[model samples]
Target: MHEKTIAELAAALQAREVSSVELTEHYLRRIETLDDALNGYITVTAEQALEAARAADEARAQGRAGPLTGVPVAHKDIFCTEGVRTSCGSRMLDNFVAPYDAGVVERFKAAGCPVLGKTNMDEFAMGSSNETSYYGPVKNPWDTERVPGGSSGGSAAVVAARLAPGATGTDTGGSIRQPAALTGITGLKPTYGRVSRWGMVAFASSLDQGGPMARTAEDCALLLNVMAGFDRRDSTSLERPGEDFTTALDRPVKGLRVGLPKPFFGEGMAPAVARVLEEAIDHYRGLGVEFREVDLPNAGLAVPAYYVVAPAECSSNLARFDGVRYGYRCEDPRDLLDLYTRSRGEGFGAEVQRRIMVGTYALSAGYFDAYYLKAQKIRRLIADDFARAFQEVDVLLGPTTPDTAFRLGEKTDDPVSMYLSDIYTIAVNLAGLPGMSLPAGLADGLPVGMQLIGNYFDEARLLGMAHQYQMGTEWHRMAPGGFN
Candidate 1:
């Protein structure tokens, strides 16, 4: 039961082969048994999950169930859940229990999917490696000693380890796709405004977009159908009509034009990872997919540009967490200035502080034009490059990361190198385009992911292409040894 995909589990629930309670308990047990080593989840809502499962079973018996009636799923800690802790993987919010459900959480509830718990993530979604998480870094299920890419590492790890069938994740730069690639899972980041940001903890507001993480594109499609909807509370939410993301899963990829950016194939990529990518391209070519070489001249500037733009936005959004209203507070205040300084200093981790300082400096009066404005200009150039490529090709393809998951603590000492871990993915966020990562193959026994970038609001086409490729390969089905 734990091994079934969301679609398979939905079918079993509809067939009455298993009750929602039984399915929920199966996962709860697995999480209880296996999660100690992985630290994938920050909180386990067993009581609430069981109650929700019972209600779903009752709804099914009365023939009032939805398509995802009994599916069990986990939420990234960044999302607010009413009466549950939404830590955002920080000490500041460790004791902060949300008073309301995030927009995505509400949608999943409406679809009758039981929430298993909240998963761990980087401190305020600021790190590439999950090591900055206050709860503890999430270990990759594939190799326990290695890191699972962040800040969606916990979400990706849970699904990869089969603790949950699917989970919600937010992508600021490469949070979803990078971790998915490292852990051998399917992750999608929809176009910027396609999903609501209401109740999701802010992390670079302009770049953060929540999406789905699961084992297959079909499962991600089902989750996306529920997650992608407009919410009046979120000003950034798109007012577009609802979409059935699964509609294009079986669409043929014959004659589909795939663009391979020359910059992504240049120096810096590991030879093993490049080999796996080449093999995936060969497989796609055999499927009648057409490949074309393209150039993203400014793509090399994505990392430096993202560091400025994202931190600037994060500085503005995170201003609400000062010692006044809620969240962690320092001991008896010496004064207003001391209260503010000590509270924040004690609440946030080192990485979060580093970003806050960098952002403050960039947005400072003397440096605004020099740093923030320049980064925004570079951002436009990157977007224009993607626009040009899209005019010539249907989709852009590249390696998700420079290499497979690295060992924990390998790059934590060098923040520059850590930031570059997202070199291939940050530009998509800058352009506000939809991007996805699908398991292509293994390199040195570690999973490698192929990124698929689509035109604005073209998630369906990306899912269609990934699903078609998955149908011809079993890479997505591979699991960690002990987990299987």
Candidate 2:
């Protein structure tokens, strides 16, 4: 029962083969027994989860349950849950319990999905590795010595370990997809504005988008159906017509053209990782899918522009965390400046400070026009490159990360090496296109993922393609050895 996918669990619930309470307890016990080592959860709301499960059982009795009525899912700590500590992996918000639910949380509750708890993240969603998390790094279930790629590391780890069947994660420059690739799970980051960001603590507003993470693309589609919708509370939420991401999961991939960008497969990619990706493409070709050589001319520049633009936006978005607001404050204050400096310095972790400083420097008076403005212009070019490539193919494909999970502290001292891990994924965010990472194969006994990028608002098509492949292969069914 614990090893079942969310869709399988839903079927079990619909047939009364298992009660929501039983499912909830099954996971609660898993978390209690397994979480000590992974450190995936920051706050486990046992009482709240059981109460919601009981309510779901009552709804089932009344014949009013929805598709996800009895499912248990967790949120990345970045999303504000009414009474839970919505710490965005920062000590500043360590004591700050949100007074309201994030738009995503309300929707999940409205659909009768049980809230498990808040999962850990990189402080303010700032790092590629999970090491930036103040709560401590989340361990990769595959090799406990390796990191669960982050800033949504905790979400990826828990879902991989079966702490929850599915979970929510946010991606601002590969935060979600990279983790999914490393942790060997399926995760999606919808086109910007597809998911409401209201009540989701902001990191880089232009790049932040939340979506679902699960063991299979089909399950991801089911979760995305509920996750995506317009909300008046989120000024940036897309007002477009609703979509049913799962409707096309069984659609045939025959004749669909997949574009392989030249730069993505070029220099610096690991040989073992490259071979696995080639095998994946060959497998897709066996499915009758055609491939083309496409060039994203500006794809190679995503890192530099992302560094400038994301931080500039973050510097502005994070200004609200001063001592006076709802988060952590100085223990004592001599004056306003002292209070501000002490609170900020005491609360933020080292990587968070690094990004904040980098952002601040980029946005400073003389540098803004030179750095921030130039980066935004390059961003437009990056988006243009993707738009042009889509005209030549149905979806774009590539490796999700350069390598599998690295051991803890391997790249912590060198930030550039850490940032480069997102080389293949950051462009998707810069283009504001929907992207997903599916477990394609293994490299050196560690998971290697194949990333799919679809045209804007083409999440359904992407999921369909991923689902088709998952049906044809067993990669998605494989989990960390001891997790079962």
Candidate 3:
């Protein structure tokens, strides 16, 4: 039961071959037995899960079950789950239990899916690797000593290990796709505004978008069907017509035009990862797909521009967590100033503080024009580059990361190198385009992911392409040794 995909589990429930309770119990047991070493989940809502499962079973009997009825899933800790701790993997919110469900969580609940629990993430979704998670880093299932990519690492790790068939994740400059690539799973970052940000802890508001993570593209489409929609509550939500993401999975890729960004294939990629991506390109060519070199000349500016814009936005969004209203507070204060200083100093981790300071400096009165404004201009250039490239291709393809998973603690000291881990993925967010990562092959025994970048709101096409590739390959089906 734990080994099945979300679709398979739903089928079993509809056939009455297994009860929702049985499925829930199986996953709960897996989480209990295997999660200690991985530290993938920050919380486990066993009692709540059983109750939800019982309700799903009742709903099935009444003919009121939805498409995802009785399907259990995991939510990233950054999402608010009513009455469950939505700590965002930070000490500041360690004791903060949300009073409301995030928009994505609500949709899943409406679909009758039971929540497995919250998965750990980087402190406020700030790190490339999961090391910054206050709860502890989530270990990659493929190799325990290696790091799972962040800030969706926990969600990716659990899904990769078969602890959950699918999970929710947020992408802010490659949070979802990068980790999915490292863990050998599928993750999607929908076009900005396709999904609501309501109740999701803000991180670089302009770049953050919620999406799905799972073992396969077919599963991601199903999850996205529930996750994507307009919300009046979130001003950033787009009022676009709803889409059935899974509908495109059956489409053939006979003449799909895929663009390979020249910048993506340039210097810096590890030889092994490049080899795997080359093999993926060969596989796609065999599928009757045509590949062409497209220029995203300003793509080279993505990293620098993103570091400025993201932190600037994050600085503004995180300002709400002061010592006064909620979250962590100093036990005693010498004065109000001391309370504010001590509380924040103790609450935020080193990485979070580093970003906050950098953001504050960038947005400061004297530096605004010199730093933030210039970064925004560079951002426009990057987006224009994507716009020009799309005119000649149906989709853009590239390696999701420069390399496969590195050992934990390997790049923590060099923040610059750590930031570059997202070199291939950050530009998509800057352009507000939909991007996805699918397992391509292994490099040095570690999973490598090939990314697909789509035009705005063109996720269906990306899903279709991925599903087609999956049909002819076994990468997504291969599980880690002990996980089985």
Candidate 4:
């Protein structure tokens, strides 16, 4: 029961082959049995999940169930879940129970999906590896010794381990897609503002976009259909009409124009990843898709530019967590300054503190032009490069990460090495385009993912492209040993 994909589970539920409570209990049991090792979840709402499952059963009996009714889903802790502790994987908010549901959470609830719980993440979504999580790092299901890519690693872990059929993840510098690659699942980072950010704790306000993580492109489509939409409450939310992303899954891939960024194939990629990606490209070529080398010349600069832009924004967004209104407050302080300093110093983890400091430095008065301003110019150039490439190709393809998942603690001491893990992915976020990671194959016993990047608001085509590949192969269906 726990091994089923979301679409299969939804069908079984509608056909009355299984009750919602029973399905929910099966997953709750899996979490109970497996989560101690994975640490994928920060909070488990078994009681609420069962309650919601019961409600879903009632809805189904009355013939009012939607496609997602009674399906279980997990939220990244960054989203504010009313009445639940929305910790954001930071100690500062460990005790903070949100007063309302984030737009994504609310939409899933409206679709009758039971909330599995909030998953762990990097402290304030700061790190590439999940090790920086305040709750503790999320271990990849494929190999427990390795890190499950970041910020959204916990979300990916839960989905990969079959603890949840699908889960929500946010990408700021490849948080969602990277983990999906490492964990051997599918993840989509939608176009910026494609999903509402209202009530979601801001990471890089300009870079953070929420999307779905699941086993297959079909499941991601189902989840994305629920996640993307216009939200009046969010100033940045696009006002596009609701879309059914699943509708395009069966579209033919023949003659589809796929771009291969020259820099992507030129250098920096591990041999194992390159080998698998080449095989993946051949798979697409066999399907009659045309591939051409396109130049995203400024893509190589994305890392430096993103570090400047994201951290600068991180510094500003994280300023709200001071000891004044809520979150952690120091026990005793000589003055307001002491209170602020002490609370933040003690509450945030080392990585979060490091980023805040760097961000502050980048956004500082004199350095603004030299660092932040220059980085923005580079960001514009990266976006322009992608825009020009899109004019020639319907979508672009590349390695999701430079390589497969690294062992835990391997790159922790060297921040640059850790930062480079997202080298290929940072450009898409900077450009605010939709990108997805689907398993290409395994490398060194770990998953190697191939990324598909679509033009702005072209998420449906991206899903279709991936679905076409998934249909030809079983990579997405392969589960980690013992996880099933």
* Best model per lDDT: 1
User: Which digits, one per residue and each the tens of the lDDT, describe model 3 over residues 1-484?
Assistant: 7778888888999999999999999999999999998999999999999999999999999999988899999999999999999999999999999999999999999999999899989999999899999899999999999999998999999999989989999999999999999999999999999998999999899899999999999999999999999999999999998899999999999899999999999987999999999999999999999999999999989999999998888888888888898799978889988998899999999999888888999999999998999999999999999999999999999999999999999999998899999999999999999999999999878899999999999999999999999999999998988888
Q: 233-310, model 1: which lDDT tens digit per residue?
A: 988889999999999999999999999999999998999989999999999999999999999999999999999998
Candidate 4 overall Cα lDDT vs. reference? 0.93
User: Please, what are the lDDT tens digits per residue for candidate 4 over residues 6-34?
Assistant: 99999999899999999999999999999
lDDT, model 1, position 73: 97
Give me the displacement of residue 208 in model 1, in angstroms: 0.6
The clash numbers for all candidates, in the given order, read 0, 0, 0, 0
Q: Which stretches of candidate 4 lie over 4 Å from their true place?
A: none
| Candidate 2 structure quality by residue, lDDT tens digits, 1-484 | 9889999999999999999999999999999999999999999998999999999999999999999999999999999999888889999999999999999999999989898889988889998878988899999999999999999999999999999999999999998899999999999999999999999999999999999999999999999989999999888899989889998898999999999999999987888889989988988899999999999999989999999988888878888888897798988789999988889899898887788899999989899889999999999999999999999999999999998999999999999999999999999999899999999888877888889999999999999999999988999988888787
lDDT agreement of model 1 with the native: 0.95
Give me the overall lDDT of model 3: 0.94
TM-score of candidate 3 versus the correct structure, residues matched by position: 0.99
Badly placed stretches (over 4 Å) of model 2 are none
TM-score of each: 0.99, 0.99, 0.99, 0.99
For model 4, name the residue pairs that clash: none
User: In candidate 3, residue 178 scores what lDDT?
Assistant: 98
Q: In candidate 3, where is summed lDDT lowest over 10 consecutive residues?
A: 1-10
